[model samples]
Target: MKKLNESLEVERIYTVLEERIEQELEERIELGCWMYCKEFCIMYS
Candidate 1:
């Protein structure tokens, strides 16, 4: 029973970390896309 409780806690921690990582990745992707688009416009124009 104790082992099961510990495993559940670990799983919860992982879930939180996963969510944080996903959010960070999304922000980074958006920033990268914006930078790319800006550069492309400058080059083409």
Candidate 2:
């Protein structure tokens, strides 16, 4: 079903992001709004 496929896709993206964050992020720190803002600034500026 379409709904089931959508659910699976969301799960897949979540898993990929979780693994990437675990592997690629700097020393374990909480993912807060400030961190996202800093990353956004770094990428755009």
Candidate 3:
């Protein structure tokens, strides 16, 4: 029982960390795209 509980706790923490990493990647991609678009617009107009 103790071992099973420990495994579950580890899994939960891993899942949370994975989710946060994914969220950060998505935010960075969005920011990069926005910056690129702004630069393109300034260059054209």
Candidate 4:
């Protein structure tokens, strides 16, 4: 029973960490895309 509780807590912590990583990746991808677009516009003009 104690082991099960500990495992549950670990799983919850991992879930939160995974969510944060995904959010950060999404933000980085968006920033990268925006920068690429700006660069393209500058080159085109």
Candidate 5:
């Protein structure tokens, strides 16, 4: 029972970390896209 509880706790922590990583990746991608668009507009205009 104790082992099961420990495993559950670990899984929960891992899930939270994974979510955080995904959010950070999404934010970075969005920032990259915005920067690219800004640069493209400047070059074209």
Candidate 6:
């Protein structure tokens, strides 16, 4: 029972970490895309 509880806790922690990592990656990609668009606009204009 204790082992099961410990594994559940570990799984929750990993799940949270994975979610945070994915969020960060998404934000980074969005930022990169915005920057690229801005640069393109400036270059064309």
RMSD of every candidate to native, in Å, equals 0.5, 10.7, 0.8, 0.5, 0.6, 0.7
Return the clash pairs for model 1, or none.
none
Write the residue-wise lDDT of candidate 5 on 1-45 in tens digits: 999999999999999999999999999999999999999999999
TM-score of 4: 0.94
In model 6, the Cα lDDT at residue 10 comes to: 100
**CA lDDT of each prediction against the hidden true structure:** 1.00, 0.84, 1.00, 1.00, 1.00, 1.00
Question: Comparing 2 and 4 by TM-score, which wins?
Answer: 4
Alpha carbon lDDT of residue 40, candidate 6?
Answer: 100
Off by over 4 Å in 6: none
Q: What are the per-residue Cα lDDT tens digits for candidate 3 across 1-45?
A: 999999999999999999999999999999999999999999999
Candidate 3 lDDT (Cα, 0 to 1): 1.00
Tell me how many residue pairs clash in candidate 4: 0
- Against the true structure, candidate 2 reaches a TM-score of 0.53
Two-way TM-score contest, 1 vs 4, winner: 4
* TM-score per candidate: 0.94, 0.53, 0.87, 0.94, 0.93, 0.90
What lDDT is reached at residue 23 by model 3?
A: 100
List, residue by residue over 1-45, the lDDT tens digit for candidate 1.
999999999999999999999999999999999999999999999
User: After superposition, which runs of candidate 1 have C-alpha atoms over 4 Å from their true positions?
Assistant: none
Residue 8 shift from truth in candidate 3, angstroms: 0.4
lDDT of 2 by residue, 1-45 (tens): 999999999999999999988876644455566798899999999
Pairwise TM-score winner, candidates 4 and 5: 4
Candidate 5, which segments miss by more than 4 Å at Cα?
Answer: none
